[model samples]
Target: MNRFWPISWQRGGLSLIIAALLVFGTVRLFTNAPEVALILGEPWEDMRQRSSAKIDPAIPGSYWGRVITSDARLRLIDLQYGFVTPRARFFTVSFDDNERVSSIRMSPQIEPLLLDDTLKVVLDLQEQWRKGGWIPIRVNYDPPFADTPEWRAQLRNVNKGGTSYWQAGNKYQVMMVVNRFKDERNPTEERYLIKLQLATPWVSQ
Candidate 1:
């Protein structure tokens, strides 16, 4: 009878181990199973539409304007002028949805001795027509000082100036550089050297 008891105990232990292994295998098979297929073919567009539908119409314009303006502020900067040239020049351009750049103007707050400074502006606008598509716009400028390594090094050390642009499914870019002396007493020396600004636009596609 004692021998019979040991055999029964061993059989029970083996059965328990086999049962545990079966349960573990079943659980892993279910976990590794492929997910259910999506009902919507393109999930992003559906989600976008649903989100837009949920938004309150009255507040959306204001919210969108705030978001766009806040985004624009990150690229904007103040224009500064030094002596010898009592005034500084500012250039601004506007673009519409049709990708047409207009309202290009340059105004000088303080008139400099020489108006030889050149301002180059470029605009690029391209957007994805499909839903959930993103396109990026970019603006770039090259400073007059960058023409030579020595002058470029000097500008990099002393003054920090550049042009400004904006992006809204479109790009408005401007580059302005001034090469003038800061003081009238130092006519033979170069004082204020302005560099063109390069602005880049970012969009998630």
Candidate 2:
């Protein structure tokens, strides 16, 4: 018998070879991935539908049932702002009269982290949004952050009140606010809050 054909043509070695070829072809098909950017550039109407589907306002009770119900005090600030220390960051979820999700506020206490900690988070978020093809649009704030000396000194503007508020959003009506505050414990140190407010079309009375 020849060494190459020692296994014998009558044997099932041919079947194993065919199976290996099929597996390799299937893997190659999946390896050639499609461009996500092209696919995700959907029409505004489609994007709106997708966004609304995330938090169906038509739903009866508060969409954040379990999330807010878990903390008794969390519910106290339904329309107003409430404070809660959950996990590593402070969390606050708000709901409209219809019990729909209105906004979510989160802040990382900077006393424990480096000075540029919040700046890093904001930059990373911006990069991700840009990658997703969303651009931030400047929105007017009632008591804008432009007033603060820190802000004015850096930004060259001022407002009436001491509090500073900066807001921006994309076409999807999603707004993000970056707030700077003096650390409670360490007065000299600063802390920041990145409040992501979902500008749902539903307006509260």
Candidate that would win on lDDT: 2
Residues 58-93, candidate 1: write the lDDT tens digits: 222121100111000011211211001111232222
Q: What's the true lDDT of residue 63 in model 1?
A: 14
Write candidate 2's Cα lDDT for 1-205 as tens digits: 1101111221233232222222211111112221111011122233224331122222344333112211111111212221122121233333433543444333322122222554454445445445554444442332323333464343222122122222222212233344444334445655344443333222111
What are the RMSD figures for all models against the true structure? Answer: 31.2, 24.8
> What pairs collide in candidate 1?
87-110, 141-198, 143-196, 163-197
Cα lDDT for residue 139, candidate 2 = 28
Candidate 1 backbone clash number: 4
Worst lDDT 10-window in candidate 1 = 65-74
